[model samples]
Target: MKYLSFTTNCVLILSFVYVVNCANILGYFFFPGKSHQFVFQPIWKELALRGHNVTVITTDPLNEDIPNLREINVADSYSVFLNHEFSNVRRESTPPYKMILFYQEVFVDIFKMQMENKEVQDLLELPKNAFDLIILESHNKMAFGWKHKFDAPVVALSSFGLPVFSHYLHGNPIHPILYPDFLSEIRECTTLVDKVESTYFTLSCWFVVKFLIGPEADALARTYFGNDMPYLDDLEKDSMVFINANPIFSDRRPKTPDVMEFSAILPIRDTLTKDLKQILDNAKEGVVYFSLGTNVRFDHVQGDVKKNIMAALGDLPYTVICKWESESIEGQPKNVHLRKWLPQQAVLAHPNVKVFITQGGLQSSEEAIINAVPLVVIPFLGDQPLNAKILKSNGMAETISPKELNRELLRDTILTVARKENYRQRAKELRDIFLDQPQSGVDKVVWWCEYVIRHKGAKHLRSPAADISLYHYFMIDVIAVFILSFYLTFKIIQLVFAIIVGLFRRKPAEAEVSRKKKKKN
Candidate 1:
């Protein structure tokens, strides 16, 4: 009897410790862009390494295999749409608005299906209170509706720079900073335009989601899950957000209590490839590496643009390695070699690599800074313009308009950027800023994850919702201004009317007095 009692006590203590030590973390990543994977992979890996049970719900399968990584392929068919050659439609495609519409349509259906499906339900219903915390990609605002189902703290991962959705969650003013005034741009100082624009953009986005995409998503949700999710506006106010952008690259904007900035999470590889290293070792002049990034295909570029680029390279005496999709170039120059795939980081690390010509994607930009390579950007679409603008403003890069894709402009810009020592000096300075941060990007993410696990709600750090009302949050100051203006206007108008009445009365009284004086005489 004594022996049996001791064994039972031992079992009970082990069970209690197991429950205490274990933490359940679920990450939801549904963005279509492949670049997001690089940003997310390290965080997931670090969590798993720390002995936390990490499950990643992704749209596509990841190539890297890691223990505790659970990938759920939610919308595999969307890949076909993403990889489709839209450039082949026409030389001058008449407003590809149809593409945006198609994306919205497909996304609404897939998101609804994923949320309502039995498989997802089963996952959600996993042993009672299975997860300690849920980390969602901030871009997937639709997922906010499902947060209530999980009994854990909801943390958001923003892979992009400071976005509106994240800003809203932290109870911060989204307007003035996001939508600065025209004059603000001129002054290069603070303005209310970012706030106004942010407010307008937020409402615009909500309208698009609610009226345009919400009904479809709701109907689909009802059909699949038998529940009506709340409207998009109602859903956005209740989550924590973190942006994956370095402050060094972005304007120094104030952040609310709930919002955090952790960027450049991907591991920096500064080693040179064997082939590139060999070439650089023998090079007398130096190398200039060029790439337009993965999203912008070289084949889609106009023949004239390609020829102009090649012609520009012909003028340069330095060796240029261009990462192209095709093996052959019609007007290939002697100094340029077209490779289907070249180790980008390897080339950047080469001592001979003096300058980088790029499309200014976040990862590539980060890599260039890490490797201390100056840039000449030819941005095409999306956040490329913003990135290019930031880099140019910082004196670390030069932006060349794509319209001026001629030999002379390309050659001149490349030569100027390469020869300018200021660009390299500025890039290295920014690198120092990044290195001086409190912790590595990966380490910060891991620390936050662990901190959430230790603190049940993380409520102490959360920003209050009251601080984020549309009027007060945006700081329209409508009431105070209106009252003050109304009071002043009322006083002015009242004084004017009194003066007019007095003037008429004065004339009548004076006439009566004149008549009385005449009668008396």
Candidate 2:
């Protein structure tokens, strides 16, 4: 009886300690696209699984009842995308600078909707210091004010790579010629024209990010969170940034310690469903998977482009699986199969699965590498072009211009990747590198989240240059001081020389006068 009582007492004490150590975390993802969720959901969900009290303000909510996890659903947040067709947007191929404007307008609309959300407003009304740490998406800068309201440290997350302007958040170096913007076509900067184009893109986008987007973000932050909130730009200070791009295949650019990267954030299944398994396993001729990701709906892919793509797939001897939104395509080939939604990673993991033709979205590219499959990229817009180019350079993929795509070109490209053993071999090498990290991406994210809470923010790990002004960062003041000192020294020496010359002239004049006096005498 005595021993039983002692054991019970020890168990009670341990439980109390566990409860005390659990942190309260709040995560907000502004982008409503499901692809972004693939990178972020695993992170916040894992935190809750680890005994933390996690509450997420998200458009895509896991409506299940999980202990220690609460969902503040902002279902209407996706309304911002309903009006615009991304296929039309891609056709226009908006330049990097103009794309910023387009995104600014779209995000501003989302800001109003999210701020005006009743559940979100109710969340804000809760007691101060309610959260121990805050996780936010980088695209939504205004949400950084939540850090102030809750008095919590922030860990900024990006679904993809950061824009050139956002490099300042972690004091990462910004190089245009070598590390061009993701939206631009200038990947290799061998020519002067390439350098010129990259320079213009970097400078112009920086101006737009600071001047045009800054004021609007500030105003929105002030109105919603509080007028006392710090400037939108400054709120990124002391925050950790995690990018979804892996450094190996990404641009060979400089990175600060604060920036963390990961490729395999989403879960990959080892088994496929009954129907999918049967189809993939029986494909002796091999299999091809094609998808345009979430933004480019299949129904919108009409007229000549659709016809050519279909014609190409029809000619291929292998079985093809495509992610289609509609019930059925009109002229869909007998060899091709369409599913409204399919498990992407599991399908890619099949043995017979060969080359994947895709829109080359970041998540898609990462998945391709993670699954060890070659690619045939038909880039549409945004980072797709850049991702495609990088993959091609790595010997893991081929790039085809969307505007120039036709039956013969599409057919030949897909066949080349599938038949060429090198593409598959290179993909396997890259996949090994991506998975060679010490811990999984999800685990790394969870550890860092807890680290910030334990240390009361990652202030020590922060970049010294992150919070400083641009003039101070560039050492303009220090350079000015040196320049001024040199100028003053030069002027002083000139003055002294002038005085010495004047003294010699005076001596000569006096000597001449004395000579004249003697001669007169």
TM agreement with the true structure for every prediction: 0.75, 0.90
For model 2, how does the per-residue alpha-carbon lDDT over 1-521 read when each residue is reduced to its tens digit? 99999999999998877454789999998788877877888888889888889999888887667799998877687777776556644513566567778878888888788878888889889887899999999877788888878888999898887888778667888878778876665677889988987888788889988888888888878887788888878777668887776755566667787788766546773467798888898999999998888877755665698889889999999999988876477888988988888788899888899989999988888888888999999887777877887889889999998788999999999999999999999999998888777778888878888888999997888787787888998899999999999999999999999999999999999999999999999
Best by lDDT: 2
Please give the range of 10 consecutive residues that has the lowest summed lDDT in model 2.
84-93
For model 1, the stretches where C-alpha displacement exceeds 4 angstroms are 1-20, 59-65, 73-128, 176-228, 232-235, 269-273, 465-521
Candidate 1 achieves a global lDDT of 0.67
Residue 273 error for model 2, in Å?
3.2
Q: List the residue pairs that clash in candidate 2.
A: none
Alpha-carbon lDDT, every model: 0.67, 0.83
Q: Could you tell me which residue pairs clash in candidate 1?
A: 175-194, 175-195, 176-194, 176-195, 178-194, 179-193, 179-194, 180-193, 180-194, 181-193
CA deviation > 4 Å runs, candidate 2 = 1-20, 88-93, 269-271, 300-303, 496-521
**TM-score between model 1 and native:** 0.75
State the local distance difference test value for candidate 2. 0.83
Q: Write the per-residue lDDT of candidate 1 for residues 160-274, one digit (tens) a residue.
A: 6644434555665545444431112111324466455444445554455546655655455444323655553444455566777786555456676657778764564346567
